[model samples]
Target: MDTYSTATLYINGKWVEADRGASFEVTDPSSGQVIGVAADAGTAETERAIAAASDAFPNWRAQNAYTRAAALLRMHELMLERSEDLALLMSLEQGKPLRAARNEIRYAADFLIWFAEEAKRIYGSTIPSSRTNQRLTVLRQPIGVVAGITPWNYPVSMITRKVAPAIAAGCSIVVKPAEQTPLCARAVFDIFDEADLPPGVVNLITTSRPSEVGDAFLRSRAIRKLTFTGSTAVGKMLASRASESMKRVSLELGGHAPFIVFDDADVEHAAKGAALAKYLNTGQACISPNRIYVQRGSIGRFVNVLTDRARRLRPGSGVDESSTIGPLIDMTAVTKMEQQVADAVGKGAQVAIGGERLREDGLDGGNFFAPTVLTGVSPAMSIYNEETFGPIAPVIAFDTEDEVVAMANDTEYGLASYVYTKDLARAVRVSEALRFGIVGINDINPTAAAAPFGGLGESGVGREGGAQGIDEYLDVKLVAHVLGDAVD
Candidate 1:
């Protein structure tokens, strides 16, 4: 075990250590072991961090969009230069494969630059007033201090999903990255420093105790808005707390995205898509498709091809360059996924190809599980109702478009869904019927900086990507200026 035990927090545009000087272990999810310790912040530290962000908001928000965009552009450039450093850090902490982490870093930077360009593009229009003497227009203004709570999975991207747009829109923020994967996210704050965002504009705090950190902001009047990326359970709680203060909230919560395979689709391609989509980041992603529904004619071929793809996955530590499947983020996740597997099997699901944890190979004693495939899965199984968040693909068969669509929409989550069909009509039909904010027609991964992302139902309110992203931080106010006095 490596002996380094402390990391820094960035608050008010400066790197810091907690006042009590306590540190908590940072485990490598890839190895089920400790890699380092980060500063453990509590309410007191959170208070200070909030003040920093609150104090900086007026000045930051008053600056021109071009200035904010310039900083974001510079940070984007630095991010590209330091890509390897951040990506490796992300993998080491988050337990995702290195390439996935790298892709997130690049994507996170894209969020920054994309929002930078969008910053100046926040459009306001002149209202046509019937009154001869009055001219009315609307202008979008920054909302004030924002509190951003990001999750461990896709830590870098989630942070950028909030921070980049908030700052680009001229809102200051206090960030609380998930304890499991705070380092890389914290390091990205260094870019803010390099970009010279005004003092107290953006702050980062590492706290193992989320309730305490969260409550601080929840109770604070200075924090006008809150954003979260996590499970639906916690998202609701956070929303409730923020409600007391009537704070504006944005939640990007959980998903059990349904992957529907129509009989008309190519089975091989669908199988590959299902395998990759289900197992990406060990399926910890909220957008990750966990429920696979194949039509009657396609079920046999799809399962056979999918199981083969799942079986081919090699499990190893995130440190290993060749390893594709890494461990879940922590021991809790391992336990959770293990129970999910047992529960599914106990409920009569059949293991198709790879089903158990992998044998620990060498140096690091990796927490590796074989890519698992479960066939004959029922909607009542835990894997369907709840998210497994692991490299497990459970295939459930359905007949007819209406049946599949009903199966897809039968969930509280409306985050994302996938449908594979050659016919454009079927693709359009399934896409419209699937109750998700984002849907994949032929593509397994359906996301880009240019498109708006988020969901329709309990998944979350409001969108996060595209030009609409920065809109979350903006407030439109009607300004009525009298052009001239009416001559009777």
Candidate 2:
């Protein structure tokens, strides 16, 4: 089987090669060797993409909801048909297990399906008015072209999460998928093209240089909204630049999520869920539980079970059937994680379970890290305030529920938090008190396209998914008139 080296950027309903037509070397994370190079974007190429998307906006916004929904439905179908290919591409660049990648592909498709149905639900309200024969109505209108800058993690789903809602709201989009994992985004964009989307309604650019594409979009007066999912530092930089044009910004940034296990919790179930949450995608998830703050009594018991489960995980190349945890993206993440681990260990944290990088010789050159568990993490440690973004879960014990809640809310991030209490009354109280965007009680898979997803404070500004998603890409308009007379 041939591996793809370069992927073309799609713009104005056409696949385009860069003017310089440069290339980049994409390495296989498992092997830390160059696997292939996709199309590399220079300044000129990025400008062309922006221009293509800018030119398409007027006509795209003119499209009715039905027309837009049909295209989305078509794109959704094609996504299903080529799931295998896209999944392989995702695994190649993203370093997730092929099955996990395939699952992500399916999850990505669900957004299109959901928003396709949601398009019909775009409705407005008529305002109640005094004065005889006077009428007033408020209509939600599309907000021109949206620039979607997605990170490498969950590339396909992130793209779908933004694009589906934008398109369903009758707005066109330009997606700047991460240069590392551009193939999946390109594949989805291909489905949109094959679905017969009007030219400029959807475009894509793959670039190793985020600055090149970012500068192009920032300088352009045509792009109306900038939606980004990445680090808080970068997101802030982009937000500052986008502010020059006063562009509407939607940001989903970093998270240092916490999992609170109360004394009354189901220890076994909570531990399993925490294992899945922390180890999913090797803990690359923004919402993955990084800090496990257990009630003091339950702490010892929790780690015993958690350690037992963590030891049994399969770690190897993403394609391996026996593998449960997969590699970090590459040496960069490994190095960063290693440094953070060292820092935490230096700050007096104890290595309770798995730690250290896996030897490639044993696993046929795969980049695998053993699932690591640490305990006694102090609040001052880097691992507490910063998101490690790796296959590491640290356990910290708290004395009381209030103390646990205070500790969880102490961080600047509020993307996600988990509570394992079974008491419904206690659950409601703690859930509301967590100060995070989403909360789960005795659950792990709390992510749903139906619910609004985002956080407060530094985590992000606007919400994504659910009915509120369209609101981020829309401008509300109110009209008032007197039916019986010019002046009522």
RMSD of each: 1.9, 1.6
Model 2, range 1-488, lDDT digits (tens) per residue?
13355546787888877667787767767776666667887778767777877787788778777888898888888899999988877776788888889889988888898899888888999998986688899998888888999988897999999999998887788888887777667667778879988788888888888887899888889889999999999999999999999999999999988999988999978888899899999999999998999888888889988888899888877766666778887677877778778988999999888778888556556567778999998887888888889998989989987888899999889899999987889899999998999898888878877778998878998988888887898888999877854675
Q: Write the per-residue lDDT of candidate 1 for residues 79-173, one digit (tens) a residue.
A: 99989988888778877778887888888989989999998898888998887788899988899999999988888888888998999888999
TM-score of 2: 0.97
TM-scores for all candidates: the values are 0.96, 0.97
10 residues in a row with least lDDT, candidate 2: 1-10
* Residue ranges of candidate 2 with Cα displaced over 4 Å: 1-3, 360-366
Pairs that collide in candidate 2 are 5-37, 6-38, 30-367, 314-324
